[model samples]
Target: MSSRQTEVMPNFEQTLLKKRGSALTDGLSFIAYGAQAIANDEFSKCFAPKPRNKVISYLLKGLKAPLSIAGMGIRYFLLLPIRIFILFGASAGFFIALPIVLRLKSERLKRLLFKLYCKAFLWSWGSKIRYHGKKPVLDEPHIFVSNHTSIIDYIVLSSHGFPHATVAQRQGGIIGYFQKNILKLNGSLNFDRSQKNDRSVIAQKMREHVFNTEKSPLLIFPEGTCVNNEYTVLFHKGAFELGAKVAPVAIKYDKSWADAYWHSRTQTFSSQ
Candidate 1:
C-alpha cells in the first residue's frame, strides 16, 4: 500500500476505538445512575433476607430448609383458601349493596356504608389497625398526606371515615375497577403516570377539589410511590401546592406477622 493509505488506515482504526470507548463509558454511567436510584440502604432492606441468630446458629441453619418448606405449604394449603374466601365474600357483598347505596339521597349514609366495607375488608385480611390521635371532622375540606408503603394504606385511611378523595396512579384489573367506580364516587382522581399531560391535569383537579367545600377532603401519598417501611423518601410538592389545611397521617406496619411493604418490582399485587 502507499504510505498515505497506510497512515489513513491507522487513523480510522484509532477513531473507531475511541468511539467504542465513549459508548461503553456512557453505558456504564447509565447503569450506575439506575443502581444509585434504587440501592440506598433503607430501600435495599425491603428485599433483604432475615438475619440469622448467633446462638446455636449451626442447629438453626440445619432446620431452616425444612421450616421454610413447611411454612410455604401451610400458607399455600391452609391460609390461601381462607384468604380467597374472605376477599371474595367481602367484594361480593360490596358490589351487591353498592347500587342501593348510590341511590340513597343521604351522602352520610353512603359514607357510612363505605367505611363499613373498608373495615370488613381490612378485617378479613387479618389487619389489626390501632388508630391514635383525634379524628378529623369530615365537615370541612382538608388534604390528608401520608407516607405510602402498600396498597392497604388506602383502605386503612378510608376505614376511619375521613371522606377524603384520593390521588393515585391508575391500576388495572380488580384495583382498577375499585379506583374507577368506588373511588370515583368519592371524587378520587386516578391518573396514568405514563402520559405526559396526566400529572398537570390531576394537579389542576386537586387544586379545584381543595377549593370546593362541597367536595370531600383530598387524600394523597405525596411520595408518589411506596417506600420501604424502614425509611421515607422525599415527597412530591403537588399536595402542598394546593392552598388547604394539610393534616399529616403516619402509618407504621407490623412486620413481625407479615411485611406490608409492597415490593412492586419483584412481586405482583395478587402475590403480595
Candidate 2:
C-alpha cells in the first residue's frame, strides 16, 4: 500500500475506536437512566400520602417549609469554617499549580483540577448534582450555552464532564484579581459587557479563540446575569456569529436542601 493509504488506515481505525467508545458509554448511560427512574419511582411511592386527611397534609407541608429553611441555615453556619477553608485553599492551590500546568501545556490536567475543585466546593455547600442528559462532545469547538441562575452554576456545569474555559466579567479587588489571573491560566476569557465596543472586540476574540487557538472548548452563559434559574434571558449572538456547533446544556440544582441561588444585591461575599 502507498504511504497515503497507510496513514488513512490509522485515521479510519481511530474513528472506529471513537464510535465504539461512544456506544459503550451510551449503553451505560441508558442503564443509569433506567436505574435512576426506578429509584425515583420507589422513593415517591414510599413518601406518598397513604389516604390521609387533606387538612393535616396541608398543615404538615406548611410546617415543613419553615423547618427546612431553618435546617439549611443551621447547616450553613455549621459548615462556615470548612467552606472558607476550601475557598481560599482551592484558590491558593489553583494558582500554585497553574504555572506548572501552563509550562507543561496540559489542558487535561487543568480540566481535571477544575472539575475536582468545583465538585468539592459544591459538596461543601451541601448541594448535590444530578445530571440527566448526554454531555456535548467537545472534540471540536462548540459554544456551550446554559442558563445562568446561581453563582455556583458554573461549578455544577463544569462537574458534568464538559471541560472548557469560561467567560467571566472583569472585576476589581483581591477575589477579582485571583479570578482574572487563575482563569486566564486556564484559557478563560474576560470582557467588559457594558460597552458596545468592548463587546464587539470580545466577539472577535471569541471566534479566534474557538477556531484558531486549538486549546480547549469554550463555555458561555448567554444570560448576562443570574436570574434565579426561573427564566432564560436574551442570549448574546456574538458566539453564534462564528457559525460553530452549539451545545445546549440544562443545569438544575436540587433546591430542596439548600438555596443555591446567589442574590448579588443582598448576599454578602463572605456569606456563602
Best by TM-score: 1
Q: Write the per-residue lDDT of candidate 2 for residues 1-272, one digit (tens) a residue.
A: 11231221234435545675566876775576567556645323322213323442343476586766666577577777787788778768866877787788776887787777777777666565678878866666667888776656777777667556778777666547746766676577787767768877777778877874466677888877665544455677765777788888777655443445555556644563
Per-candidate total of colliding backbone pairs: 0, 0
Q: After superposition, how far is residue 21 of candidate 1 from its true place, in Å?
A: 22
lDDT (tens digit, per residue) of candidate 1 on 1-272: 11232221234435555674577876775576556555543445544434333433333466586776677688789987887788788779888877887887667767777787888778777678899998676555578899988898988988885556788888888788889878898788989978989988988998888888776677899988877776677788878878778889999887665677787777777787
RMSD of each: 11.3, 19.0
Computed on alpha carbons, the lDDT of every model, listed in order, comes to 0.75, 0.66
Q: Candidate 2, after superposition: displacement of residue 135 in Å?
A: 1.3
The pairs that clash in candidate 1 are: none
lDDT of 1 at 269: 79
Q: How far is candidate 2 from the true structure (C-alpha RMSD, Å)?
A: 19.0
User: TM-score for every candidate vs. truth?
Assistant: 0.71, 0.65
